[model samples]
Target: MSLEIRSLEIRIAASTDADAACTVLRRSITECCDLDHKNDPAILDAWLGNKTPQMVANWFNSPTNFSLVAVSEGVVVGVALLTGAGKLALCYLLPEARGQGVGKALLARMEEQACSWGVKALQLHSTATGQEFFARRGYVDAGKVRSPYGVETVFFWKQLDAGAEAPDGGKRKRFCNCNPV
Candidate 1:
């Protein structure tokens, strides 16, 4: 059953969104990323060890990180984080939100944010489940590396046209209708 996202909002995550965003992050890893974790208790536990609400809140509040959440019908269905060093730190969506454009919207917004920040490129370690998604979005695979959780991950990077400036003069563009609230 596909979830028809009638009203989806992408916005900068606030402290109050930590709980729901954490839920999305955990659920996406546990449920949607079976290929990466393979239902192994040890790997799952290690990967999820620090995915607490408090940690998520800290990520949202960090000055060096930009966090965003995808809300559908007032529920956080997706979460993404971009580091100031041009790393695409986190990008995950609930299982039901897959193939629903939420990931694309989140990624587009992240790229826009990176460009606004004068980031020349965005880099990430994509799990098996996310490799194709990132590839389809123009990310080039650099090589494979074993994640800390023992999962084989692909390193991907995308060069951005950072020379382009937003109409508002270097501010992030609302490319995917994402609000920075």
Candidate 2:
């Protein structure tokens, strides 16, 4: 099933929006990413601990961070944050928002912002669930990273300023919208 995303809005997230964004983020991590965490109590606790509403709010208000939210009908369905240092720090979407192009919209906004900030490259740690999403956006895998919580993440990087060719200077095929009609 896909969401009828009429007029989805992507914008910078404000501190006051933290509560709702935190709910979406936490739910995406705990429920939407169950395939990776497997409902392990320790892993869930470790992952969820860092996403407290207050902490997320602080991140929203941080000077060195830029956060964005995707809203449809006034509800924030997805969230992403990028650090000033060019790290695509986080991206998460509610289960209902997946496969509706919300992630791609959020990613494009973040990448544009990064380019405007003079970022030459961008990097992110993607979960098993998000590996393909990042790949489709031209991110190349660097390798795997294991978190202290025992969850393994894939490292991905993309060159923001590379022009007329892929960062690796190889011919690249653009993503095709292959969803069946």
* Cα-based lDDT for every prediction: 0.89, 0.86
lDDT digits (tens) for residues 92-155 of candidate 2: 9988889889999999888888877877678999899899999998899999999777789999
- In candidate 2, how many Å is residue 19 off? 0.5
Residue 164 deviation, candidate 2, in Å?
8.5
| Structure candidate 2, residue pairs in collision | none
> What are the per-residue Cα lDDT tens digits for candidate 1 across 1-181?
4677888999999999999999998999999889999999999999999899999999999999999999999989899999999999999998898988999999999998987887777899999999999999878899999988788999998767534355467843233322332
Top candidate by lDDT: 1
Error of 2 at 97 (Å): 0.6
Q: How displaced is residue 92 in candidate 2, in Å?
A: 0.5
Best model per TM-score: 2
Query: In model 1, what lDDT does residue 41 have?
Result: 98
Q: What's the TM for model 1?
A: 0.88
Show pairs that collide, candidate 1.
Answer: none
Predict model 1's lDDT versus the native.
0.89
